[model samples]
Target: MDSETTIREPRAADGGLDLSPVSRGRTPLLLRFTLFAIFFFPATMVIEPLGASGTVPTLLCLVLLLAWLASWLWGLHDPIPVRHPGRLAISLLLLASIASYAALYAGWTGGSTEMTRASADRWLLLLAASAALVLVTAEVIRTMADALQLVRALLAGAFFCCLVGVAQFVFRVNPMEWIQAAMPGFTYNGGDTPFQIRGSLMRVAGSTFHSIELGVVAAMLIPLSIWRSLTDPRGRRWFHWAQTALLVFAVTTTVSRSGILGLVVALLVFVPFLPRLVRRGLLLSAPFVVAGVFLIVPGFVGTIASALGADTSDPSIATRVNNYPRVVQLLDSHPILGSGPGNYTPPDALRILDNQYLGSLVTLGIVGLLATLAYFLLPGIAGVLAARAAVHPALRGLAGAVAAGALVAAVCSMTFDSLSFPVFALLYPALVGLAGGVWRMVRREADLRDDENAATARGAMMARAPAPTAKEVG
Candidate 1:
């Protein structure tokens, strides 16, 4: 049969394709993806930075990576190549890192074999994660419609985790009963250094490795809620409102100053777009937002203040500052490639600099640092431009806020930590894919516009031409 005829036939009725499962209430692709995001993302914050002997989190990462790969191999979806110039730039940076590592291994007499081995392992893990990032980019592009679903899922999951933490704090109990029921004998692996604020309220860490990590998670969700509230329908307004309030409560309870700053940045960046949405949304949500502040802010503020003022005796912050000069001295000695990839611990490697750029420079050298910066900055720029060019008004608004929020997170987090954190690592590639999809849509629209203009111009010319006469026909 001809292709058209074959398509017209009821192939599923002919037993060519199974439709029963689809006809039943099986989850749609978007919803399945959303559920996956919801289940998996919150747990990322809880993954032990100090490696667990067991493989739950590692195994989960592997599974996610495989799922991303399977999506591509099964012909379910294909992602366009990212258009950022930084991709090439960063690859070159990795090459430079390899070169630096070679030099360090050859020349650095100070390096210990065991220490070198550990650094090498970390580097290998980083490369493996980078490969997974490529898969995530492909999967996201393949399933752009599912992107918002995944984002909403993340928001819901973060809120739920926060709620659990809050409940633990209020009741002064280990809320690990549900956890134990879910994964019998699953010990909470990480150390707990609880934040002590003047207020007697117990700060809850939930399942996250640290209360600070939990705070960051809450901060990240606020922008998404604000975006949805402003752009989603009135019936959905309450959902966003409730979500925002919950997230704010979570952030306040965690009491990370960095988290507070991140939230403020998200809000300020989003407020300009609020007026563009239905006025009722902004007005309706405003009172709830204010009320949440009264309910949430004091505890968070006090906790943050205590952490900052706690002690000159504990020189973690001071040591980080003091150690920078020696790091800079090493950088000056080996400026081009630096000591090597994972070869930065000199005789006096005092503190792991709480700065991504500095840490990158020490290992990857100038080249790796440049590459890392490109990887981050390129996505943010693409996101902003794509949001500006989006055809759908709601998506444009949302993309803009997401872009802003990610940008703020990048800048703020760099002061306190590196991208080695699970959430940050996942978000970097995910945002890249989002920007890539929006850019693809933008280009498609431009192409369509050009074609439309050409057609219109041709029609105008035809209309202006005289009708053919009998002489012309002869």
Candidate 2:
């Protein structure tokens, strides 16, 4: 490759020409740990026995915060990329969360109580940790290669989960229970049942606390895996395609209507950005793919059909529909700053509102709601914009995948408390941070190209000058 092309290429730490600002300098240990943890998050769940209050994700966040603090104290923390619009939005959201929590604690919101106060405090801590994560991720993932590495990790994690889910479905094994049994203190909130059976087919939840959560994760991965399969070189293309199949199977096996819808939404967001041939091929193959799956597992098809049809008789759907009015009433009572995060009491037997948007409104109020929306939407918009401007094909595809994942999470939030879940909560924001980093990299490359072009033009003009040097010298 030419020097200009080499400058645009993504470089690794192993002797390649490092063009990324983040990669140019020695990466801090804490930042490296955070990056590694994020990619291997699924495996990290196995260490839940060490988590506070039996919540592994919470423990991980705490560790992240401590690492960040230690890094700061040691003067190893990189500057937060505040110039990135997505990062700026996240910082604003964190500030708003703190303010809202303070207002709730002081009874300024009119709905505050001891329960709300405690809940708000916990949420505030989580927000702080999440802000730190965003900052660290943006600082660390400064190139297309870095972003792609994270995506590959996510695919690997998703593939493993899918394999576990498949085993759970086929063999009726409860891996969570098995793990808890092996380690006495290891506990999970998922039920004792091996799988969730719906319409004569077994639903697989994998290692996540719930089936819906697994579905959401699978939905987010599908688009990204598809993009990778198409764009990756021949050596790795088949592997990514296989991963895509596994992810699709996992999503279907979850028997989650919202999950399917989320996948559809993500594909809709992703397809427009794809090459014409790939787009056409996907559109044409989708039906055959569905038909083939149905041929293999007819019972699974029934479950999907029933779920998609919005069967009012289905207990889950009925519960969600029934809970909508109560959620609205709760939101009405606390329209400003909310009662507190995770503090809204359900009016009925159902404990979960099942809708993240409504739950946020009731718990965090209008200000928090707006902030949450900005946190999610701003990064998604930034990803879409970055995809348009990205010079590298892989970077552009990765940006599109990020945007799709954000949209999928948003769609899933309509049916589940997606933002509260560990995988969704952490992964979504991290992807946004990655998107912001990619955007900055694209902008820098564009600026450099412009400067190079301008310099070349100036040199040409000087060469074309009519004997100006000889005349001036004389």
lDDT of each: 0.56, 0.68
Candidate 1 local lDDT, 43-98, one digit each (tens): 32333443332224344445556776687699775634445432443355457666
Which candidate tops TM-score? 2
TM values, all candidates: 0.74, 0.84
Q: Per-residue lDDT for 409-429 in model 2, tens only?
A: 767888887766665676676
Worst 10 residues of 2 by lDDT: 16-25
Error of 1 at 123 (Å): 3.9
TM-score attained by model 1: 0.74
Off by over 4 Å in 2: 1-54, 80-82, 109-115, 182-194, 230-236, 311-315, 347-351
List, in order, the clash count of every candidate structure: 0, 0
